[model samples]
Target chain A: MTGAALRLDDVACVRGGRMLFRGVSLSLTSGGGAMLTGANGAGKSSLLRLCAGLLPAFSGSVVRSGGVALCDEKLALDNEAPLHRALSFWAAIDRADAAQVDAAMDAMALTPLAEVPVRMLSTGQRKRAMLARIIASGAAIWLLDEPGNGLDTVSLDLLGQAVGRHLSAGGIVVAASHQPLPIVAPVTIHLPDHQADAA
Target chain B: MRLLWLLIRRDLRLAWASGGMWLPVAFLLLVASLFPFAVGPDAALLARTGGGMLWIAALLASLLPVDRLVAPDVQAGVLDQLAARGIGEEWIVLARLLAHWIGFGPPLMLATVPAATLLKLDAAAMARLELGLLIGTPALAALGLLVATLTAGLRSSGALAGLLALPLAVPLLIFGAGTMSDGSGAAFKFLAAASLLLVAITPFAGGAALRAGRD
Candidate 1:
C-alpha cells in the first residue's frame, strides 16, 4: 500500500435541496490521518461518503490511488450469521485470507464473540465488528464516519490503537468524530456551519 | 464472474434461509387447489380454463416475494457495501435476478405438476403450461427485480411494487395464456420476445434506480 493517497479538490456537497458545504479540499498521502470535526448536521458523514464515491460530489472531484473501506453507522453484515461468518463474507469479498480475519478479530478483541450472531451483539460490539471489517478489507484508505459513537473507554482505546497501527503501517485514515480520539492525526477539517449562515 | 457468483450464492442462501423460497410455490399450489372449489368440478370446464388460470396464478405468485427482494438489502446497506467494493450495480442486479429466478421459477414449475393434476389439465395443456412458464418466469423475475429496485425506498413498497409490476406483466400473461389456445407457435415466440426484452433491460434499469436512490 505504499504511495497510497486520497485527495479532494474544491469539493462541494449538496443534500436535500441545500448546500451542505462547498470549496473544501484535502490531500493525504500514505501513513497519514485526518480528523473531521463539526457539530451535528455539518456534513462530515457526507464528506466521507463523497470520498468513498458513495455520494456524487455536487462540484469538484475526488481522487484516490488505492482500495477504500468505509465504516459508517450501518454494520452491513447479515444479522443472522455468526459474527465470524459475517465478517468473513466481507473478508472473502476483499480477498483477505483467513489469517487477516483472525488477526482483525484479535485486534478488536472479538474472538470470544466469533460464534455469536450479529443481531445479538451490543452497540459497542457491533461497532467493533464494523471496524474489524475495515481492518480485514486490507484497503489502503479508510473512511470512518463517527467511528467512536457507542464505544466505552476501553473500546475507545482499542479503536485508537488499531488506527495508530494502521497509520504506522502506511494506511490512510479520514475519520469524523465529535469526541476527541487518542490517534494522532496532524490534519483537521472543521466544517463550517453553513446551515446557520443560510438562516 | 466470481463476484457475481458470490452475490448469487449469498442471495440464494438468504432467500432460502429466510423461508422466502417456498412462498411463491406454496401460493401457486394453494391457488391451484382453491380454483376447483371456487369454479366447481366440471372436468371439461377445468380442462378448458385451467391452464389460463394457472398462468394467472403463477403471475400473482411472482409478486409474493417482491417486498424482500431489494428493500432489505438497501436498508441493510449491503448494496452500498458492494458498490464501495467496485462492484457495478448492474452486476448486482443481474446476480439477484439469477438468484431470484432460481428461488422461485423452477420450484413453481415443479409445483405445477401437482397443480396440473388438480386442474384436470390434459397432457397437451400441461406441456404448454410448463413451456410457457419456462419462457415466462425469467421475465417475471426481472420485472419483480426492476420494481423492487424502483420501490425499494418507498413507504409500503410491496403494494406499489404490485401495482407497478402487474401492468408490465400483462404482455407476458397475454402471450403465455395465448399459447394454450393459439394452436400456432406465434404466441410462444411473442412471449419469448417479451421475456428477452425484460431480461435485457432489467439489469440496466434496476442499476440506474439503485444509483438514483442513493441520492
Candidate 2:
C-alpha cells in the first residue's frame, strides 16, 4: 500500500455508439482516495472496469502502479470449487495459517459453511469469500464495484475499515458505490450527465 | 504459476465437494440408459452404438450446466475482482477451462462403463471402447468449455451451447467412435490432435471469454 500512483488523463470511452464517459481525468497518489457516483446505467461500473484494465479505453490514457484489486461484477470462481479453495485462489495471497482461515471464517461469520462448495453458497457469503481474497491480496489500489452489496451493516463496517486501513497506509481506494460508504476518507467524483435535457 | 495452480486447485476442490462434478456424469449415464430402453435392449444395437452414444451424451452432458458458468459471477461482481488480480484474462480463462474439463471429463468417462453395461455392450467391446473414451473425452471437454465460454451469456445458452459447439466436436466424436468400431489408428491421432489444439487455443479462447463475460 501507499507506494504508487494512478493517473488517468482525458479518458473517453464509446461503446455501441454510446459515449460512456468523455474527457474523464483524475489522479491519485499514495494515500489518496476517490469514489464515483452516477445514476443507473451511467457507466460507473464501466469506469471502474477501465481502471481495472479489464476494458481498454477507447481514447485517452490511463496509468497506475502496483497491483490493483478490482471487485468485478463477475467472479472468477468456478462452479466446482469449495469455499476454502476459492478463497485461496491466488496462490501468492498470504492466507492465515490453518488457525487464520478458521479465524477469518469466524470474523466473517463464514465458519458454518467452510466446507460448503462456493457454488452452493448464497450471494452474501460469496461476497464475503471475495472480501477475504482482497484482504489476502494486500494490494494498494482497491477498485471496487458495489462492494457493499449483499453485506449487512457489520460486514459493511468491516469493509469500510479494511478500505480505511488501505487508505491510511498510503494506498488508493476508488469505488463505484450505490450507497454512500461509512468511511470519512472517501472522495466522490460526481460525473454530471451533460446529455440530459432540462426536464 | 502460483495463481494458475491455486485456480486449478480451487476449481477441482469445488467440483469434488459440491457434487457439481456428478450431475454431468449422471446425465451422461441417463442418456446412455435411454438408448437401451428406447431400442428394446438388443445387445448388438446397444453395443454397436455405445461409443457414439456415449460421446454425444458426454458432449451434451458437458454442455448442460454451462449456461450458468459465467452468469452468476457476472451478477455477483466476482469477475471484476478477477480482472483486478492483474493476471491476464487469457490465463484466468485457461485455468477455469481446465478446471471445467477436470470436473466434466473423468466423470463422463467413468459413466461410460455404466453406460456400456446399461446399453449391453459386450465385454471386449466395452474394454476397447473405454480406451477411446479415455483419449477422446478430453477433446469433448476442451471444445465444450470453449463453446460454453462463447455462449455463456446468451438468452438461450442452453440451446446455443450445442448449436455452437457440436460442429467442432462432431469430427472428434466421429473418429472417436469410429475407432472403437473399426479399430482405426487415425481416429486416435485425430483425437490427440484435437486435444492438443484445444490445449493450445484454450488460453486465447479464455481471454476472449473474459472480455465477453465482462458485458
Candidate 3:
C-alpha cells in the first residue's frame, strides 16, 4: 500500500445534464487524507464514486494506483446472513484473510454482534458494519461517503482510530461528510466553492 | 476463475436462502398440471402437443426468477462494491449467468419428469423435451438475467422484465418446441446456436446495462 496514490486534475462532474462541480483538483499519496465538505446534492458522493472508479469523471483526469474500498450509505452485506458471514463474504472478495475480518470487527466493536443477522442491526450498528468492511478490505485507498452517519460518539472515535491506523500504515483516506469527522484530514475541499455556476 | 466461482457460490446461496430457486420449478409443474385441465384430459392429444406445451411452460418458468436475479444485488450496492474491487462488470455478469443457470436449469429439468407424467407425454416425446430443455434453458436463463439487469432499477421491474424478455425469447420457444416434431435434428442445432449466442452476449450486454444504470 506504500505506493498508493490518488490524483485528480481539474476534475468536473455533470449529473442529469446539470454541472455539479468543476475545476476541482486534489492529490493524495500514501498516508495522506482529504475531507470533502458540502451540502446535499453538491456532488460529494459523486466525487467519491469517481475516485473509486465506479463513475467516470465528466471531464479532466482522475487517476489512482492501488485497490479502493468505498463505504457509503449502502451496507452491501447479505441481510439474512450472520454479521460475521456477511463481512467474510466481502473479505473473501477483497482477498483479505479471516484474521483481517476478525480485526476489523474488533476495531468497530462488532465482535459481539458477529452472530446476529445483518437485518437485525440498528442504523448505527449497520454503519459500523460498513466501516468494518472497509477496514477488512485491505485496500490502499478508502473512499468513505458520510461514514459518520448513524454513529455514536464512541463508534465515531473507533472510526477515527481506524482511519488513523490506516494512514499510519501508508494508506490513503478520502472521506465526504458535512459534519466534522474525528479523523485528521489536512486538505478539505468545500464543494460549493467548486460549483460550476452559482445559479 | 476463483472470483467467478466465489460470486456464483454467493448467488446460489442467496437464491437458496430466499427460496427463489424453487419458484421456477413450481411454476413449471403448475403450468404442466394446468395444461391438461385447460385442453381436457385427452391422452392422445396430450401426447401430441404436450412437448410443445412443456416448452412454453419452461420459457415462462424461466421468467419467474428474473426479478430476483439482478435487481436486489444492484439495489443492495453489492455490484458497486465488486466494481470498486476492480472486478470487471463482464466477469460479474458472467458469474451471475452461470449461477442463474445452475439454480434454474437443473431444477426445471428435474421438475419436467412429473410434468411429463401429468401431460401424458410418451417416452419419446419426454426424451425430446428433456434434451431440448437441457440445451435451451441456458438461453432462457440468459435472456431472463439480461432483462433483469436492464430493468433492475426501474419501477415495476418485475412486470417490465416479463414484457422485455417475452419477445426476445420467441425464437427459443420455437426451436425448443420444434425439437419434438422435427426429426431432422436441425431444430436442435438451431436451439444450440441460439443458446450459445445468448449465453455469450448476455455478460457483455448486461454488464453495459449495469454500468449505464450506475450513471
Measured over the true interface residues after superposition, the C-alpha RMSD of each candidate is 0.9, 3.4, 0.7
Interface RMSD of 2: 3.4
Using TM-score, give the best candidate's number.
Answer: 3
Off by over 4 Å in 2: A72-133, A145-161, A177-188, A193-199
Q: What is the per-residue lDDT of model 3 for residues B82-125, given as tens digits with 9 covering 90 to 100?
A: 99888999999999999999999999999999999998987888
- A1-199, model 3: which lDDT tens digit per residue? 9999999999999989999999999999999999999999999999999999988888999999999999988999999999999999999988899999999999999999999999999999999999999999999999999999999999999999999999999999999999989999999999999998754
List, residue by residue over B4-65, the lDDT tens digit for candidate 2.
Answer: 77768765775676666888888887788778778786777777777678777776776776
List model 1 lDDT by residue over A37-150, tens digit each.
Answer: 999889999999899989999989999999999998989999998999999989888999999999999999999999999999999999999999999999999999999989
CA lDDT scores, all candidates in order: 0.92, 0.72, 0.93
Q: Alpha carbon lDDT of residue B181, candidate 3? A: 95
Per-chain TM-score of chain B, candidate 1?
0.98
Q: Distance (Å) between predicted and true CA of B100, model 1?
A: 0.6
lDDT of 2: 0.72
Can you tell me the DockQ of model 3? 0.87
The CAPRI category of model 3 is: high
What is model 1's DockQ versus the real complex? Answer: 0.80
Which of 2 and 3 is ahead in DockQ? 3
Evaluate fnat for each of the predicted models and list the values in order: 0.73, 0.73, 0.82
